[model samples]
Target: MSDPITPLAKANIPNPKDGEIVAVAEDIWWIKMPLPFRLNHVNLYVLLADDGLTVIDTGIYSDHIAQCWDALLAAPPFTDHPIRRIVVTHYHPDHIGYAHSLSERTGAEVLMSQIEHEKSMALTTLDDVAFADMMIKRYRMFGFDQDILNALAERGNHYSDKMTKTPDAGYIQAGDRLTSLSGDWHIRCDRGHSEHHIGLYDPARRIYLSGDFLLPRITPNIATPLAAAVDDMLGHYFAYLAEMLTWGDDWLVLPGHDWAFHAVSTRAAGLIRHHQQRLAQLLDHADHAPLTVKSAMDALFPMELNEHERYFASGEAHAHLYHLVKQNAMICAPDQHGVDYYELR
Candidate 1:
């Protein structure tokens, strides 16, 4: 089938520099690597500790990233000390892609939040096959054509090969203090973006490794189709934002994407404001007559969207619309074709 969206190569974003490590702090390095989506790159962190090296996140399971890892493992700094543990911030393929491979190569234990580990395991199970099919139907209900639906399902199944083989060695919970990698890093867990999104905080350095909780440029998506109970992604997101504001301005934020920066408080405020603005825009565009979710999505992201862009755009639009409906600001109705329609309440 012809791809609905242009391939990453045609998107014109620069391929990530090969195997270059940017130092975010003393003994803490950021390894920016390529992702096969509209988002061009993801930042994986590495820390040199007294015990052994700790890799915070692994890049996508692509040949380029594999080669980059091979080079890094064979290089001076990384070669000197073996990796002690492979710690994943979340279950997202971009963050945990090469984790299994790295563990196999170095005999490193893979540590992740219990929720993340369970979700990852479920996605690759036979029981998940029915769920995957149901997801395809749900996307179709949102007005996506068969071609796009197929692509989405294919991408979903692709995780079986990309993720690590080892089960989580240990589960890290919220408010837990980790003393392995650094002196003491606090674990903060939030929902909405991913099932068990984990962030690390170093009190001494005043640094926070925000997996996808607090990105600098773009807002982390807060939509979950696979949530067990009520899927209140926007609610989870705003609550997380409130939690982030409790931090001091002096805290340095090392996000999953974008460059590391200071001003965590300000960034958290800006993200909250951005969501408010978006919700207002959506409400204003939604009139008395019911509007399909796709119409609302186009109204927000009017630029010509390729397949890859549409993937995220559709999910994001659904997230905002779902939030509005829950807040009683909007209503969801279905057309005869079974497509969902959103309207102002």
Candidate 2:
């Protein structure tokens, strides 16, 4: 049965506010840039330094975003200094979309984690035909219908134009300390969410730039993508949570998607508990009978679904099921149709 589309779109809707520069500290400011996706904004940071300015996380490479950057640079706060460096938190399109262009314009050297830089460059050259075929085969193995599978195949091409060109240069590895106008920021790297997602911590100010690792209102999506060896994403996610929890509760969190908050410990605890609840729910469903990934997704997200939701739902379900299988709490057996049937161990 095809699910309705209304709830999916509504669930992923993005809320954009009037653009403003927020002073995070004495010489640091954050600018929220617009994006085209349902989660329609990204936070870009600017640091006023003695030598030059540093801009972090340029917005997606659209005409509108380019104009926004131009306007801001022309304004008073940013008019004096040239951008000496562009520090990207990760390689996501929303985070590094205008990196190449901005680096060219400002002569800023782009800095990112080595793992993120390699992954980002690979995305730029992904072959559409091969990618679509892989999506169809993966969905078929999970028991999605032809219609839903077809939609998933074409969705990637839809957003290809929004992706920015890869950076001219490469990345800065973890354990490298960044010194600028704001002083030294320590880089901490973790996996699970995205390969080698980098978070910056300034001990002096007790602030953490926690890219997509932590969000206030919504849970971060943990999906099992094709051609990835780390199939147990749920396990990796919990490990990442544990790593972040060690940063102490009092530190202010600067997230990629949500507003800045000081509840790092509380938010980390909540995320861990949320995943526990999701695992329990999956276990209960598996105990009743063997379930296909598609059926499990429908059970977990029992609302109107669309092409986007369907794609995400399958990936999320696969992540959880793979984790449970690894822990011996669930067993997956292949049927003649080639779909995996999962049940409680």
Candidate 3:
């Protein structure tokens, strides 16, 4: 069954019906698609043009989303217009999963950051069993018990499962401007969330298509890569947020997950505060005892999490601890078991 479209245009609809596309402006449209996570949805934008349409951020690959696309393209607004190019903001599974699928359908060019494209390719070649075993070993080093390790191994590589094979992509970078009938969008790239995350801003319209950069309600997950915990991922995130504060507060922020809102500086400041508080929490907990990533995770986020949540939570914990290490507030040294643990300096 096709999902029904609502009559009204939504600058901000908290939750539109599935497969519905609402107008954000005169020509641009917004659609929310289902995601298999706590966040639950990813926002996709369609820029209309007489020549062709430009899609910002493809939703994850799945049967249901495929149906939604079919219904969307077959309808008014989206009908007849070709998807000229797909501008992917990042390489997260939910954002880039269907880039190739839609590109294959519409004969559209896929545009992505070189870093994200390479990361996607590397992730595609990752063997599930090998990935699971490697994660088990790393989680063990982070002080995960055998039970959590077993659950993680069974989970395997969700990214490989969720992400469709990437298509050949044209590279976009900072300072590049994408011109279309709708408007000119300036590209800005930052590090941390994924190696190089892209955000698009339209100066004319004052719209910021912020993908996982500064979410409205929840702070975006700042995670260290599983292979190494030495990188200051959280620090990078803070630096990016600080830079965003200077971008002014008048821009309308269209985030990847949540509802659209204004006040970009306010959102950025709140996110910075959230992480700072988390860092403080971790620092105080470590003062009580030498802590592993697992211990820090429980202290910072003392809530029940399923296997999937655990994976992200572990990285978040390591990111904060390692950021403190970089700040010289903490030190990471291996214990007698060769397990890395954090202690106050």
lDDT of 1 by residue, 1-345 (tens): 111221111112222354677655556777887776677788888877887778888987777888988888877558788888778998888888888788888898888999888877776563435655766766777777778777666565555556545355578789987664455788888887887888888889788889988776677776645535537687788888887788857777778886676667777777787778778888877864566657767766788887656656767778788889899988888889889888877
- CA displacement after TM-score superposition, residue 188 of candidate 2 (Å): 1.0
lDDT of each: 0.73, 0.75, 0.80
List clashing residue pairs in candidate 2.
4-305
Give model 3 RMSD, 1 decimal: 4.9
Against the true structure, what is each candidate's TM-score? 0.86, 0.88, 0.92
Per-residue lDDT of model 2, residues 191-277, tens digit only: 666767877778887877878877766677777755456478778889988876776667777778767776676677778887787
Tens digits of per-residue lDDT for model 3, 1-345 = 001111112244345555678877766778888887777888888876667888988888888888888988898566757788898888888899988899999899999999888878877777888788778877887898888888867777777787678778999999998766677889999877877898888999898888888666666788886533357888888889898889777777888876787777776777777778788988888778989999998887788988778878888888888898999999888877757999999
Q: How accurate is candidate 1 locally (lDDT)?
A: 0.73
Question: Of the candidates numbered 2 and 3, which has the greater TM-score value?
Answer: 3
Poorly placed runs, candidate 2 (over 4 Å): 1-17, 156-159
Q: After superposition, how far is residue 29 of candidate 2 from its true place, in Å?
A: 0.8
TM-score of 2: 0.88
